[model samples]
Target: QEELAKKQAEALKIQKKNDELRAREEQRHLAKNTRVFELPLSRYKRKDDLKDIAACLGLDLNGKIPELTSRIKAHLDSNSVLQANPRFCGLFG
Candidate 1:
């Protein structure tokens, strides 16, 4: 009976640990999902187009395509004046 009690205690400890880990993982997933980003620019049909978009967004040319696109979207979202610009709107929207 003593051994059974010890085993039950161990099991309870492991179960509690597992529950904590699950909760932490769920929190991480929720945080990731809640993050807001956007893809402002479409695909580049030419290399020059890619350069122009990066220049216009003030993002580094070395950044990945998706990251640059997201930054551009965020910029446009924050700056209504940029959104109002005909050239900027034509390129991104």
Candidate 2:
């Protein structure tokens, strides 16, 4: 009846508020637990930069720009040898 509809609507409103609160709490928790790191790439790089990076990382890119970029990014992500190289290290940091 009308009373039942009113009760259901009130319950739904409460549930919606509870869901919103939970979402906000989860977002706060995630922000608090997150860690961020940043690396700097060279400014004003040209074709020669890619070629040099490929050479230092020993990646063969066959002169393709997309492949060259991805390979360089991957190498910079975790290759200690590339990171340690004074020449390439300057490019990244």
Q: Write the per-residue lDDT of candidate 1 for residues 3-89, one digit (tens) a residue.
A: 999999999999999999788556545544233223346645444445455565555645666666666667767877865665566
- lDDT of candidate 1? 0.59
Query: CA lDDT of each candidate?
Result: 0.59, 0.61
- CA shift at 69, candidate 2, in angstroms? 1.4
| Residue runs of model 2 more than 4 Å from their true location after superposition | 1-44
* Candidate 2: clashing residue pairs, number: 0
Which pairs clash inside model 1?
Answer: none
Model 2, range 1-93, lDDT digits (tens) per residue?
Answer: 999999999999999999997885555445432322123554525654465446545677465766777777777787767556555566566
**Candidate 2's error at 85, in angstroms?**
2.6
- Per-prediction TM-score: 0.43, 0.43
